[model samples]
Target: MNSRITSEIFEATAEPDPEAGLFLNVATNGLAVLDRLGLRERIVDKGHRSPHLIMWSSTGKRLGTVPNGPARDPERGSVVVRRGILHHVLRDAVREAGIPVTFGARLDRIEQADAAVRAFFADGRTADGDLLVGADGVGSPTRRHIDADAPSPAYSGLVGLGGVARVPGLAPTPEAQHMVFGRRSFFGYLVRHDGEVYWFANVTHPAADRDALRAVTAEEWLAVLRELHADDPYPVPEILRHAAGELGGYPIDDLVHVPHWSRGRVVAVGDAVHATSPSAGQGASLALEDAITLARCLRDAPDHATAFAEYQRLRQPRVEAVVGYARAINRQKRVTRSRLGIAIRDAMLPMFLRKAADDTRNDWLYNHEIAWQGSPVGGRR
Candidate 1:
């Protein structure tokens, strides 16, 4: 979802293949704006409910649920589908706008002059434009060229593994995201109505080199997951045992403080400048927000300098706040590494859920709206 796609985008992308094809359900924070944009027909709410969280202890006991909250509840939202398919839908939107997406064009270096910015690629290709938007993800070459001294992504001391499995007996939990706080780590899975289970687990172990991670086979990792959730809940170990297709793990990393989001004619967006842990479910949403906002700034601002400055000024604070919030959530998910910590966490989780359950608290994290056709908002600072 573009959150609030401009009129041109909305008209051009009247029919997106991904949205028209996939039937999977995903719960999110901001579908109301999509609904308001007359795109609500794209959201398929078969049985998935919004604003529901279900956590289980290692031994299979239900901890509790936070029904609806200022933190979890957004205005009539939550859309679900395979993320790859979601990418397709977005790609269709871009294609509809007549923007071509090219692959295999790796950046080798950057060269800019007073009037135009040009990027030289490793493949001996070059592209030039008035401005370059670097959305090349966390390892963005654009970010480096924008500010050579920009900080690297900080590792969060956790490893993440996820896979999807099909079991006909499995019943859909709808929009509820199921999390397991195991004795040694964390495991989470949710059953879709189709009995398809989307699962992910986090292990709080020592950080290893990327080569080390590459050497571990899926079976080897699954064995470790078996041990991690050996004493945990019913499906925790079972899901790992039933893991299908490319089970992989990587260190959870985030860009806590980006020194420069925009410099001169180059501007970075999404994970390029503000990569957040997946715990908060805002990374994709924030990036989508960045896309619309950046477009608005460039369209309305009098000059490229003002547009770049305004984009960074408007987005930096919000992204930083989300980084901190997700870090907090990441700590909670990884806290189960110790026995004492697990006991304390399990005991206090109910209280924690209660405090976050209140609405009308003016929570800005999930409630911020975009001014699509006007100047960007909240840039006074």
Candidate 2:
């Protein structure tokens, strides 16, 4: 949601900077940026602090993504935390900064007034705000209220399984032994903060029986994976063979279009407006970008209407490009077929990676910064 990128698109121009880590930084630091701006707080809870953070590996190997400081992984490109965790962190921060929170208080409706957002809740509660950001996710009531004709999210024809296990850290070789099974499926190995090993598998499935998936025990999942991936590379079978407890399975979905992101005083962000397939691993990053950009535009615009216009103006094209990329990558991930399909996939991966690099290079999303003005607090109300 950086204006640099947004403005470039509006002017039919290209971004000046498109480094690999540009958007990655914005995604990871979005909450931290808001906290630093005094709009939120830095929270530290004992059991689970950031619920939305997903430690993963795009290739599904010992290459799982973990939180890092200044140094970063060179080969995996950019890394960002999941959206839920980012939201939790920011919510906690905002609370500490004197913003109240309404949990389990689902929004039933959002009605825009001349100068404020009148949001009604399921429990018949309501709140008024000069600006409203719909980060409520894929089935966002905010989006529904704003645009009843907004397109619904569609399945991307891919499903994923994620799990954590304790393995011989030295045996698997987190860096060296992390293996991939080509285009068939993705397998990963990760080391948790508590020294537990973690792994995830990206598989293509036509329809997911949620109950059947969760009903199976971890050992059962291993057996199923073993049978499905008999022809895969070495560690994939081995990793699943050693999987423990319940394995997690989830479907991937994409939202192709949303007519208008902003209408009067309400503006949707993240999956609320442009939910995307996970194949591109940009969902969280995109949401983080939305949060930062929304804050920046709302602060800069002279009025709420202007701010909403600017927000949509800045986010639409970039989000559309990203959504297209996610769908395309999902097509490759969902391939399960003839020898011809296998051969084409085998040859297309490298080309795909190269094109991905190029596409990101011509964008400014990676260079976003959460702009904070005034006392880093109540400058805009």
TM per candidate comes to 0.86, 0.70
**Candidate number of the best lDDT:** 1
Model 1 TM-score, all chains together: 0.86
Kindly report the root-mean-square deviation of model 2 from the true structure over all alpha carbons: 10.2
Model 2 residue 371 lDDT? Answer: 48
Per-residue lDDT tens digits of candidate 1, residues 257-307?
887787778888899999988777677667767776687777777787887
Error of 2 at 98 (Å): 1.7
lDDT of 2 by residue, 80-171 (tens): 32233444555556656565554556777888778676877777777776666777878788788888888888876666665656655424
Off by over 4 Å in 1: 1-50, 67-75, 359-362, 374-381
Candidate topping TM-score: 1
